[model samples]
Target: MLPTRYVRHSPPKETTTSSVNEPKISVQVLVLGDIGRSPRMQYHAMSIAKHGGRVDFIGYQESTLNPGLVENSLITIVPLQPPPSLLRSNTLPFIFAGPLKVLWQIWSLYYTLGYQTKPARWLLVQNPPSIPTLFIALIICFFRNTHLIIDWHNYGWTILAGTKGPTHPFVMLSKHYEAILGSFAPTASFTVTNAMAKQLRSRPYNVRSPILTLHDRPAAIFQPISNSEARRAFLARIPETSGFAAAIMAGETKLLVSSTSWTPDEDFSLLLTALCHYAESTDKLPPILAIITGKGPQKQMYLDRIASLTSTSKLQNITVATAWLTAQDYATLLACADLGVCLHKSSSGVDLPMKVVDMFGAGLPVVGYAAYESWEELVKEGINGRGFTKSEELAAVFEELFADREGKQLARLRKGAVEEGSRRWDEEWDSVAGRLFGLCD
Candidate 1:
């Protein structure tokens, strides 16, 4: 299931926030849970504080740490933890986890809203409306006479169901909640594509304000690097390419794929399996390294399965590598690779992998599985990289990223990512922050 969230409730008839002379209106915006060490949350919190207002964010304990740092901006990091698992293992019925999660959500909403002595003037929430927290947040706003902003990072149920395949009733109910809450609260939101924004508009109660999806990064990252220093950079960042020696190698080319995990979804398996097929067909099986960073529900199971596949196939070419690194280092590693690959479990049409944006931003030619139309659209086929939604399509992109036309064209296509970042995404955070804090208004 998707993580907990703070939802918006009924709109207020009137608000007292009109006076411009009001000394930086104290805005207490509470998220659904604690900030789980998410840099995204940190970035948002900092953005609010930058505007000289008080910002508070609540999220799960794993991602959101308490006692967070807030400077001049209106941001605070609130923390929370999931209730202990009632079942001994993850094999329990979805009905159980689903209800348990909702209970926690209810608790969070009550704690944040029912207890607020002074109602916050504005509330910011993610898109899923089923979250009691989001609904409770809206109640706080109504009582306090504030405004709301809903953030749609991705489709939670869509991403999770991609891996599990076929949803349980609980999952369907979760989606129903998402639809209801999303429709109920009107606010500015994030959309990966214009098509998605259109779908949101079709919703019965989607509040429309502004839709800003992922944008480009700093131009410096994508700037050209001379061939002379290319090898130096890749070799220097050896940690990223740790599986180089042990992974499968076909002919002269080495195949590599990478992905990160979210709560219920880990979407790269089909692509990885497809890459495995590619290795099987070729005469020379160069090292095929599958590197995964970060953690999620299926991480351990994935590692064991890949190792089993390698042992059974009697090919020493495939190896699994994992570690944690700073964002810059992660992007640097992508820059050093012979190719970049992203996988999405088919169900995950809702989420636009932030890493995909990062990959293109890093000047890496990305090979992504087309789970969302957003990624498919970004790839433009044969330009940035390729998307493989099915078992048959993976090897073709693998051939491109490793050999065929892909090898020779890598430099130019990779360079495109850098320009996209600088012009499209990275620097805009300041503008976004400014607007969120009411500086531009």
Candidate 2:
């Protein structure tokens, strides 16, 4: 059972720090998410596993399980299901089943707890603390002599609400939980994008605490290819690519769009309008292929918004790719695209994203509109990508990036950045295996 809600996710003001001398502990990994289908951290964790250590997976069965995972790693998967009600679509009578879904994750976690063994050296808890399975793992780790590790993928506690830096009761409220979790988990570390890491280290949370972990995944390679040959292959697989791209070519200029899977709060409607205006005035419409990879709760809302926007503005090229694609193909397309988009609402809980890193890894740049410190940090002003908070600022930035020789130059620089990002990954977690596990020096 969850501990009594004494602090209500709030922590004391007294700050804490870790000694420079690293503490020793036995390490084993316990993961959440539909292990097979979870593309983001699952792969990163597996990458760490390849570095040499034991990786045990506790996840549900998914329809599109990666064949590679089953073939490659010695991962142990635990099958658990959310109540069937969670997966089934809700009806109008119910209004919203948001709370019900959250309950379902927690319910599954309860079962995950029963399957666990006592104590390992390291316990990586990917969160929102949404699922009961994770909490159970935390408790089990606590009992079995394992220290809990927080990946701050959720940063749920630090959520702010808008384009500006911080705001109102939300900020104050978020601060309380951030501190509480800071003290509560000794082995905590944040896997934040550059912007978040920079902010947490300098402003809110200090670095030495070992609580702020930078999630330094390699960036995608963004290279421009006028591929006549590969284009055919891409078109064949992408079905409707010819008509979609062609129609959109005359269809919309500078199409402002967003991913469908992202929550509605991080909506890019205002930004889309700005992009539309930029195109109208400049005669350079930036067509958008808004590929909403993976279905999430907000998919329908996004589709509706996209449909509405396209119909009114009658923007030509703004299209959506809702179909599932293999991970490699997914990476390839994102890397090949003109630009990638992301938005982090102030109300965003733990706004860490694998896409931001993957964007950079694929050598593609990202344009992020962030409220809290997350993907926003990755856009180094004139460097890897653009980070915007205001809708007004977006079109101008996008135009600047797409215009002349400068845009191509920027793309190259962004691609070059992937090297440094890869180095960061190797540097940060290179010794993670040795440290977490009793591996060789």
Candidate 3:
């Protein structure tokens, strides 16, 4: 038998503010990742705070929180302690134990909320680590009468499928479980792209609540910098590059930057191959410095590959550097680069890469690898950047962009990148957030 589809008859109405005498609205944001790393959730929290709500942000602890967020009186951060080493190291046990801990903490918070004065209460949760967490949240919301709002990034099942293949029993179970839970009617739901929104709407259990697209945007800190200034800053940050200082100072060097998650989904090997092709294709090519950012499970594997290339002298003229940069340093590094290479082939082919957005915000032209069609929205060939399927095609695109003797092509692409990047997607979040928090009139 086909599953019944739940549908909403009306779109969400604008939420109005209470009278001056009334208590302010309150929100509890639940995320399984580091709040510092989850920019979308952070933006939503900031928006709620901006609109006179008290936001309780609950998430895993990190080394630091955003300084501006820390200063916001309307927001209080509660960090979740990590699980014990035994559970953390065992994948299956951690999966079951982790959500149980989150459920307990949330229940404790719910108990605390009972003592507080009456106000509009909402729970905004980020998903994938989705299933058991959302399922638990639904139970709590049922008892507390708090409105639930889910920000869908991708299905936890799809992520599992990436690692464990589609036919795995766990993957199949997760997929079925997510569909069932995702269909419960919430106050509203949001996703990062229109494609993702469409996918969520099509879910059988989806109770047709208003699902809106909330695209990721670069923060204000990512602005354009002069090549000279950026190069100087880059050199200062990594003093080991003093050997290339003379070449960079003389304008005989090009900087290529790639931001990656270092996962299998992103084929960094393809990018390394492209670089080797770029080197061997032309002797006239100037010295190239490549900076690959972000740290993940596959960092050592890529580092070993880079070392192999170095030892073989295959890329003697090309210097590759990798670092896991802080937000501030990452932004600065993006601003200094000549070109950005995005190796991300989306794991689910639904979520767009925010790294490309940050790169564009820094006015850096990107050559991206597209696993699906939706990527075209960002990497428009000849408009802002180019997209490719194979290493050779990407190498060819790189050759054209970097090997231009007259410099006209590079200048034009840079202009396109800056123009396209200057459009602020972040500004749209304020209105969407207002609607989500019932702060809008």
Most lDDT-accurate candidate: 3
The 0-to-1 C-alpha lDDT of every candidate, in the order given, reads 0.55, 0.52, 0.74
lDDT of 2 by residue, 271-311 (tens): 55655655465455455555556666766775687678677
In candidate 3, what are the lDDT values of residues 285-379, reduced to their tens digit? 77788888776788999899899998998886888987766777778777767789988777678888888888888888888987684697677
The TM-scores of all predictions, comma-separated, are 0.77, 0.71, 0.86
Model 2: how far residue 51 lies from native, Å: 3.6
lDDT of 3: 0.74
TM-score of candidate 2 versus the correct structure, residues matched by position: 0.71
Off by over 4 Å in 3: 1-24, 90-120, 203-207, 226-234, 240-246
- Which lDDT tens digits does candidate 1 get at residues 189-211? 65555556666776643645666
Error of 2 at 240 (Å): 4.8
lDDT order of candidates, top first? 3, 1, 2
